[model samples]
Target: MTEETNGAAEPKAAAAPSQPVMQVLAQFVRDLSFENIVAQKGITNAAQPDVQVQVNLDAKKRSVENQYEVIMKLKVVSNIKDTQDPMFLMELEYGGIFHIQNVPDEQMHPFLLIECPRMLFPYVRRIVGDVTRDGGFPPLNLETIDFLALYRSELQRRAQAEAAAQTTPAS
Candidate 1:
């Protein structure tokens, strides 16, 4: 109340250092599709059954100021025994959005993209397996995914493609 200690004259306290906030704001399967391309009786009546599966994972970031929406997309295709037609085709794109307002600079990159998806992936994977089982097929047990390895492989693939394109003769 005194003139010597005006409200604005008080020394401000130093801000508390930023700390990581671990959270999954939302998680969901954004897209899912199942296509049985060979429903024809002749194709389904093959003498032997063999299955081939192709799996893929993809990710993208949607940034809005201080927050981000990270998506992990998974695709699977299965070919039935003795037929070229796909017996099952499933694609799922799941995502989580996080409000990481006060996260420190050093940890932000890993937290928003890596850790969030790491937390969300298992749930999504389970859903895929269960859905496949529910659809009257054997559960598709996916192997444990190495995200870092996958990312590296994709980068190498892109690099190789680019190099090949540059070396090819222009026709």
Candidate 2:
């Protein structure tokens, strides 16, 4: 065979796969409110109030290019279990701006909801603790969250809701 017909030059090795691109552009507290309902009494009273905490996650694509905003909404309410009087209330909406590239469309939802929130949780938790401590109550140290579990639960909930809607007659 002619030298031109043969593989005269060794073929170059295949290029390495590109790495997935994910980055956090910024993180901030969108909104925060801490209310001491009982004021001095709430602070001075030795009785400990039962504290209830609620957290919600939301995400949306920003108008800017390749950017998304994820928000963590946290609410804490404390009241004396015996008396039902409110001791304090705290609400915080913490947000993060993220830039994600090269992630598959199927993976984007989970990444935004689970991973973005996972990255932002520590800052939100710290602020909550600091505000509570500054508000005169003991520091409210939040426990670590299981984002994967939360994401799975949310998916299951949506699936059930859709199934129910399909079965029910529209009014």
What does the lDDT come to for candidate 1? 0.66
Question: How many times do residue backbones clash in model 2?
Answer: 0
In candidate 1, where is summed lDDT lowest over 10 consecutive residues?
Answer: 40-49
Candidate 2: segments with Cα more than 4 A from true spot: 1-9, 12-16, 40-44
- TM-score, predicted candidate 1 vs. hidden true structure: 0.65
Predicted candidate 1, C-alpha RMSD: 6.5
The pairs that clash in candidate 2 are none
Off by over 4 Å in 1: 1-20, 36-64, 101-113, 162-171
Please give, for residues 6-112, the per-residue lDDT of candidate 1 as tens digits.
55776779987767665566777778876544443334523343444343444344555666777777777766555455676777787777666677777565565
